[model samples]
Target: MSYKIIVDGIQHKFSSAHFIVGHDKCGRLHGHNFHVAVEFGGPLDPRYNFVVDFIDVKNAIKAEVDKLDHRILIPTASKDLVLKESKDNLDFTFSGKRYSVPRDDVCLLPLPAVTSELLAKHFHDVLSQRFKGFKIKVRIGETSSTFAEYGE
Candidate 1:
């Protein structure tokens, strides 16, 4: 019998960019209780007789998202600013406005913004690298009522 298991991860993000300017510098610094759910599909493992080990999946997925657990996630390749990384902090600047984030509590992703779709793809890509035994889908949510999923 084909078996499958779905695991979900939760995080919080303070983001405000969406390719279209609305509000000010990300709609006045908003936050979201982001929820990420990953669904794995495939036959049971030969050794464990399961599609995937839950702990293994958890570790892999967590490793990717734990970066954004409770922080301001931003793009590392933005032309309108620069990130000055120190030993324990990062200075994000835009038009002379500086946003300082603790190095231990911030994530600099290679994205233009922390949108739902990009967040999904980001997790999917990371997990795909660690878990190639089964297909997966990563879901990112702005709230309990809004979310997005990405995978093969």
Candidate 2:
């Protein structure tokens, strides 16, 4: 009566680290060949005898990450973040510092950092809002050896 789905993707690679305020530890700048994974669960369709179609799941994931990939991910909390969107390029700012990373190099994420764990939870939370009666899991791997997942 229940089913699951997973959506995954990978980043071209970038180097950066960030942490929320009230924290003393510094997250150094680093790059990760990130891999993303996602899972969804719901009632099985009587006709198909399966949960949501795999194609639907995959398509949804692709649509989401199309907004990311090959971009400098930044935080909204940074006072220096200056975002300028136009027909030509996307601009960002932080601490009076401006980074004119090519529009192609900026991935505007709904999440805070590029970490796999945060990405996992961010994916889970977004899909959960769209699902009517289902559970989902999202896993993002920073490397072949390091990955993070979120669900239930």
Which candidate number would show the highest TM-score if scored against the true structure? Answer: 1
Where is model 1 more than 4 Å wrong at Cα?
9-25, 86-88
- Inter-residue clash pairs, candidate 1: 16-26, 45-50
Compose the digit string of candidate 1's lDDT tens values, residues 1-152: 65679886553232322221132656344567777788998998789888888888887766665567666777675666578999998887765567777777677788866678888998888888888867888888777789898985
lDDT of candidates 1 onward, in order: 0.72, 0.60
Looking at model 2, report the run of 10 residues with the lowest lDDT sum.
20-29
lDDT of 2 by residue, 11-87 (tens): 32323333332223323333555556766677788899777777876766666665555445655544434578776
- lDDT for predicted candidate 1 compared with the true structure: 0.72
TM-score of each: 0.77, 0.68
Count the clashes in each prediction: 2, 21
Q: What is the lDDT, from 0 to 100, of the residue 29 in candidate 2?
A: 30
